[model samples]
Target: MSLILSRLKCPWCETPVTKAELKEKNLLQVYLKRQAFPCPHCNQSITLPERAEKMISSGLFVSVFLAPVFAYGGWLSINPALLFSLGVALVLTGVYFQKLQKVTASHE
Candidate 1:
């Protein structure tokens, strides 16, 4: 019989699992050796199944968690170059995710 990977869903949010979000709150290990994923919609760290946990942690996610208030606090002190650097970082992050998607698609 062929192996079937299980899809993990969030118990609280009832959404499919995402690798990145799962890693955020240390939930991936709970389902190790099983096929499961974390739901992207809810803050709940649900589990799901997959060949591997490969998810892109985008700048948007990081910014939401780490930027804004920090940026605002230094908005007056920091130069425009700081924002430009952040933009560049975001662009690179997007490109990296695109590349990851292409690679994963080819595998499937």
Candidate 2:
């Protein structure tokens, strides 16, 4: 997956946002912060949804579960099947998050 598709975009202008920009505005500090950041392109204040934040948190948890399995497999030996499964899992997770982002509307 491309970085552009993974990162959150400005709701108003649809511009890709960097983590640094979000952190600078304190929007990425926490899931419950409810802080708003202005879009660099459209100047519209964007408030992230709590549901979206939760989705991301849960996604991380899911990835954590997979990480150990992959690590153990690597420790044993490189298995093509295991690697393929991991790649599929990652792609599915990315798709799931992208769908969540699209459905979760930002407060204008």
Candidate 3:
């Protein structure tokens, strides 16, 4: 009797991953290997999972909630402090989305 196996390819590079490869490496090692993945065909570098995780951290989630509040707090003359807070929030939201878009895209 023969066992059939399911294969997973690197999303960016399409490199075939074997079960043996996974068995020997820790998750962090696996993640780091992908950070600068060189596509055999295109040689494009893939984003590291940790970096992506950092982009989508809870701080960014909070920022998504906070940015608009700070941005529009004072419409006539936006308080400089409020504007600065809003700017920071906007940056966090941008980073969060940068990480999230990939996950969302995969589901669709």
Candidate 4:
């Protein structure tokens, strides 16, 4: 899936942005909000693509699909802590590696 190739690269300048820089700029939360912010290199506005949003939310989908399996394991001793940990891990993975793309074209 395209999610696997997602990176913090700028769409305009094609410059690679680091995760730390994004975190420092508090842009990580912007992904979920689909907010626009200036690119560090070119100052052009950029935002997360829908693909990124879905990817960021895919954790819930994944958990749903795996629930039966986990439920079986729960019967065999899987604990809430483990399930919670897995959920957190999936969300973290989604938060990272989000591809930044130029916002939709001008209102013209």
Name the lDDT value of residue 53 in candidate 2. 41
Using all chains and alpha carbons, the TM-scores for the candidates as numbered come to: 0.25, 0.43, 0.26, 0.48
Q: Write the per-residue lDDT of candidate 1 for residues 1-108, one digit (tens) a residue.
A: 111134434566555555566577675565454433334465433323232223223344444544555566765565544554565577464444331111122332
lDDT of 2: 0.53
Off by over 4 Å in 1: 1-58, 79-88, 100-108
Best by lDDT: 4
Q: Model 3, 42-98: lDDT tens per residue?
A: 434333344433434444444555445655675566564655555566556545434
The local distance difference test score of each candidate is 0.43, 0.53, 0.43, 0.65
lDDT tens digits, residue span 1-108, model 4: 324344567889999866567678776566446678777668788876665446556766546555556676766576655665676577677677567778656811
Candidate 2 Cα errors over 4 Å, as ranges: 1-5, 23-32, 59-108
Worst 10 residues of 2 by lDDT: 99-108
Better of 1 and 2 by lDDT: 2
Q: Clash number for model 1?
A: 12
Better candidate by TM-score, 1 or 3: 3
- In candidate 1, what residue range of length 10 has the lowest lDDT sum? 99-108
At residue 103, what lDDT does model 2 achieve?
24
Per-model clash counts, in order, read 12, 0, 0, 0
The alpha-carbon RMSD values of the candidates against the true structure, listed in the order shown, are 12.4, 6.8, 12.7, 7.5
